[model samples]
Target: MSELKLNAIDFISFAVAGNTFKLKANLIGPNDQFHSVNLDIAPDEIKNKTIGEIEKLALQALRSA
Candidate 1:
């Protein structure tokens, strides 16, 4: 499958109780269409992760959608 291109990542909010993060991802689909997706991330999920790694995760999710 073709990879989705990540255009931007925006911070939406944080849940203090669960320590979860809400992010908005702006991506370019494989067909060159633009898309915006919301993602819920746990602390463990992002620990020591690079921006590229996060982008890969978003791309994977978008491809499966």
Candidate 2:
């Protein structure tokens, strides 16, 4: 098995959303904040993502705060 280095995530910033704190991203997608996760996958088992898929998911996840 192998580990895949996905994308880099940056903490954009936090804001006061009403009585709670909220975050924002510097790029595309829903801009939701999620805890970091490391997945274990075989080299061949890793999905070959297309440019659009990378953009839609990887970049989106990376840009998310």
Question: Which candidate leads the pack in TM-score?
Answer: 1
- Alpha carbon deviation, residue 35, candidate 1 (Å): 1.2
Residue range 1-65, candidate 2, lDDT tens digits: 01223344344233334332222212322344333422222333234634344334444454352
The alpha-carbon deviation from the true structure for residue 7 of candidate 2, after best TM-score superposition, in angstroms, is 14
- Kindly report which residue stretches of model 1 are placed more than 4 angstroms away from their true locations once superposed: 1-3, 29-32
TM-score of 1: 0.69
lDDT score for candidate 1 against the true structure: 0.77
Error of 2 at 27 (Å): 6.3
Predict model 2's lDDT versus the native.
0.34
Q: What is the C-alpha lDDT of each candidate?
A: 0.77, 0.34
